[model samples]
Target chain A: MTVTTPRGFRAAGVAAGLKSSGKPDVALVVNDGPSDVAAAVFTTNRCKANPVLWSEQVMADRSARAVVLNSGGANCYTGPAGFQTTHASAELVAQQLGFGAIDVVVCSTGLIGETLDRDALNAGIEAAAAKLSADGGVSAAEAIMTTDTHSKQVVREGRGYTIGGMAKGAGMLAPALATMLVVVTTDAAIDAETADRALRTATRETFDRLDSDGCMSTNDTVLLMCSGASGETPDADEFTSLLTEACHDLAQQLLRDAEGSEHDIEIQVVNAATEDDALVVGRAIARSNLFKTAVYGKDPNWGRILAAVGTTDAVFEPSALDVAFNGVWICRGGEPGEPRDTVDLSGREVTVTVDLKAGRQSATIWTNDLTHAYVHENSAYST
Target chain B: MTVTTPRGFRAAGVAAGLKSSGKPDVALVVNDGPSDVAAAVFTTNRCKANPVLWSEQVMADRSARAVVLNSGGANCYTGPAGFQTTHASAELVAQQLGFGAIDVVVCSTGLIGETLDRDALNAGIEAAAAKLSADGGVSAAEAIMTTDTHSKQVVREGRGYTIGGMAKGAGMLAPALATMLVVVTTDAAIDAETADRALRTATRETFDRLDSDGCMSTNDTVLLMCSGASGETPDADEFTSLLTEACHDLAQQLLRDAEGSEHDIEIQVVNAATEDDALVVGRAIARSNLFKTAVYGKDPNWGRILAAVGTTDAVFEPSALDVAFNGVWICRGGEPGEPRDTVDLSGREVTVTVDLKAGRQSATIWTNDLTHAYVHENSAYST
Candidate 1:
């Protein structure tokens, strides 16, 4: 169980002939709730998909009872007909679950600018509804994959309630949010306002810091739902922590299963003037192709790191910067500190730490090295 | 002749032991001017190289008589010692040319954070001075190359004066200013103010628009020197146009010889609300990894282009955007217009045109496709 790990939730996944490989490509999650409260975040990109447009309206009131997701066509830039398809899919889910059509959310992933198979989606909705079960979380997780190699799922038990989630994404991963679709469910007693605030805070600290690539997608979305079936009204702070942990787990799984990534890098920025400054600095370094390639070759080229740092406007004296790879300080006080040969990078995970020595603020961004496999996978993805 | 194609200039290149390959690593260009007037532009990156710091001060007085460039070490982020080495190199050139040390400019490239060989540089300056000649421009161009496959040189003749220049840069190229070292010389009769205005205007329209890899360097510099060898003062507009043509010529050479690039892409954005908006939108699309990789694979994926456009805040309606590959209109009014297979990309140069339909302003940016060779070259660059 993933999304259904909590009580008062049911899900189902079914093949829709939407994917060329004949894989399951449609899923539905329903909140069988004592109370229905919902919150969601969408891609900030202006070119949103049709499903995103439909769901943004349903999530406006912070109350959604069901979510329908399909992973074959993005249904973006397909004109008004695509929007109508999304609206009809949500209506189909609402009718089967005995909920208002306005209480249904929708999401789509895969090639943009293509029209979804309306008949296949309609048949898939009926079949998925007929097979809805409390133990269908794993199937639901598997239905939302495009380039991802595996399903991502996580669960965190709180003091009295439980938080669980599933996510799917691979190639176009970056900040503000990973290029992903995520659904989180909880049995904790919470209000709509609390759910909205907690979800925003949790995502900002976790999902928004992973910059696998610097590309933002048109269909990225995350949804959080509350069933309130546990009858345990935990403090909002405690619930937020559990939600953050669950999202973090799912994000890590996405990173590990990212397409063609050989090395995972953590860029930790410390001692900046403010939290925003740290984040800005870390993101700049994380996106540097020269620095990323250096990490791929296991070359401790501290000069490239400093060069990347110099491109940002974050507050820090150039002569006061310090950089370390792993546990060895290769550069200190803006000068060479140790021989670069002393540092070893013969592992899959690399940690680059930068100390700005400006103040007491810090942030960490996760990235991957630029490798031949990455180039090959992305270059040949669409075909 | 490159820099020496114009009158009143002498150049020399010498094999300095600073390079492990025993290639010509030190270069000198002297303005044996009746009127010594100069103007320069430095990298906007805050983390600048030591030589850039020195050249910025020398070009401040607009009267530099000589320039010394070395290519075996970047001499950046090496602390006070690096600055001292740059000062020493300029002083050696001044001493050899019988001028004040403040009248000399300097530049360096190659691996960063490594100390320059002081003994080798001191001896190389003496050798370069002894061999300085009017036909040494080819050697000077070759000496400044790091990973560039060939030398870049150009000459443009106005009605009464001639302008010649050479530039060197390959991988870490972007703008504000292209990350490269450039030196231009002219025999026109011009004042310091006119030289400054002409150089700025020319570069702003040419080199500032080429964004090869979206990585800004810490050591980029462009310099223009004027000598009143031709006693004819041409109109400022004529001089600016000639200089722009010369810079554009050399910038194209850099693009052709860019490291590990298989395809050169020109992104032209037409009909924007303002020039800046056009540039912003063009750059956002040009720097997108998804769009670049698609081009590398020879796939006519217009959806990636629209996704990149959607990430920018530039003025454009999602439903009003149009995109074309080569001459085939693949997307019109934000929907599929023609078959993607109709567009062919079998050549090294590809053009992508976008019509925003918001206003009348336009801009263009040149970039390279993300390829396997780029990944391999950059990954092992410092190792």
Candidate 2:
């Protein structure tokens, strides 16, 4: 149930004194591969982090032998000095592992606009490289966490290969990407193009659909590496399916562990003019503070739901829309239908279904309800 | 000052039994005009309320004699029955004022998807019409409130005329319009075309730029009625300027009285490529929950501001961006500049300035910080 569960992968984590709490903050994962294939996706935010800027060059050839990550400072907007810290850290890892610096990927997460201590980062990377082992995935996961309460990991078995992954994200989650860092490893013999295609497809349906908050981050990266140690060249379709399952599981775990969230909401927009329209409508509802707060109160206020839907440009007649809360149709034909009291909202899991009645396409988005804790956690987070 | 401060206008408010609290829930305003020129704007949300739909038609001919407003129910998504209630209320106001029903406008606010008592609404309209007087504008303003803590009223004296108006909104504020009901009366001798242009211009810079919570509503309406009682044909530009001032005053009042807000934030985007780009950047920062929460905490987290700005497509180099909280530039050249500790945010008013370094165009957006009281208020509001 960890990234190292896949064959030909070794990882390590170390406490580098970068974090004030003396917790582990540096991680390294290396691929001992017969076939070295890699693919990655970075945040689309125009303001790229120093580490992201450095790693984007490493992923240019779609092949990376190692990845080093730290969780003290994001090193974003810290100027040229921050870029040097990232470059030096990667170069130290490459030197320790006897590999070229160009093949090393780097990631950082924490408070933005702060420079990292170069000496501590370099020593941590050297130590991480020396301690890399096949069973070090758990520590690697633990090191990547910033505000996460627990480490998230998943392992899926294919016909003759295995896929494993780890993710860390607590808040600043939105579409396109989130303030998350994910690393997935597979032993399947997949080509670089196929790995890229599968990773994009899986993330688009899973991580890209989770809108914990409407804020995007400047440091988000997801990387996939294939080592082909299982000697099993699984079919591309089957590999994509397993990868998607792994990603979906990790996404759910992230949603459940979102910062200060009480309720996990699944907004399903069905019967839309197009899948894009469904997604647009779902995201609008997910981003509504009013709707999120109502759900937090367990009020079953369907009026807020319709009001959010009305804000979207999705193709749907106002008079023809239908909404349901947890399978109880509270609004039908855009008017009051079943009693709102009939809908139960005491549980942490809630589902809101909207029938657009425009066409046959549909989409689903996951989000968290707004609560006092959410405001509290976010208000004092960086202070 | 209130809507009746202008000559040739009489208004009244009365309890209609529509609100269970038995507060003043109905209001009527009549224009005994030498000219009945009128112009109005409704919520841009596609799912408009019954009153907005009815009033939209009354403004078709660019003329109106009276407007009736209620605060017990939104009459939105209540289907055809809700439309009938709005129509019947307008007719009752017209009958009492001895005018055609088509010349009377209607507006409603409160819970959505619930049917209103038509008989009670009609009786309240009659009572309001009977009690109408030049000094009743305050009562009319009080009647249109939903969750607002106090009534909002403004009066501006022109060279030879006066503009008086009232607005009610506590939450669900966004661009295009908020969940607000506004009635502005002017004794200036202007045609409907000029009135329409001036109103759009005024609202565009004032109310349209006030995004309290980033939630557009279904029952927002702004109406302007010209009585021509002053018989002063003021310069068109001067009238627009005065109108903009009045609207800005009311908008500031609305921002101050926003639901459970502890801080009113002004986001000014300077040196943008265009005014639209400036507005886009300002609105993006205004709608960022992370930025608002940081302000509520008084943390002066300039990184969150930059992260929000990064999400917009406005023309600007990320490395050249600068941000300031209050009067201190904490972030310059995309890096930390002044110490955040030097910035003070203990006051209710806060200003965030962003220099895009793209052009000379700029825009300002007003918003409120997200606070615990905001979550608590909205969570339990509908319940």
A56-89, model 1: which lDDT tens digit per residue? 9999899999999988888888878999999999
Per candidate, native contacts kept equal 0.80, 0.77
Tell me the tens digit of each residue's lDDT in model 1 across B44-123: 88889899989999988888898899888888887899899899989989989999889898988877878888889889
The models' CA-based lDDT, in order, is 0.86, 0.89
User: What are the per-residue Cα lDDT tens digits for candidate 2 across B231-320?
Assistant: 999999999999999999998888888766889999999999999999999998888888888889998988888888889999999999
Backbone clashes, candidate 1: 0
Specify the highest-lDDT model's number.
Answer: 2
**Model 1 alpha-carbon drift over 4 Å, by segment:** A171-178, B171-179
TM-score of 1: 0.98
lDDT of 2 at A279: 98
- Model 1, residue pairs in steric clash: none
Interface RMSD for candidates 1 onward, in order: 3.0, 2.8
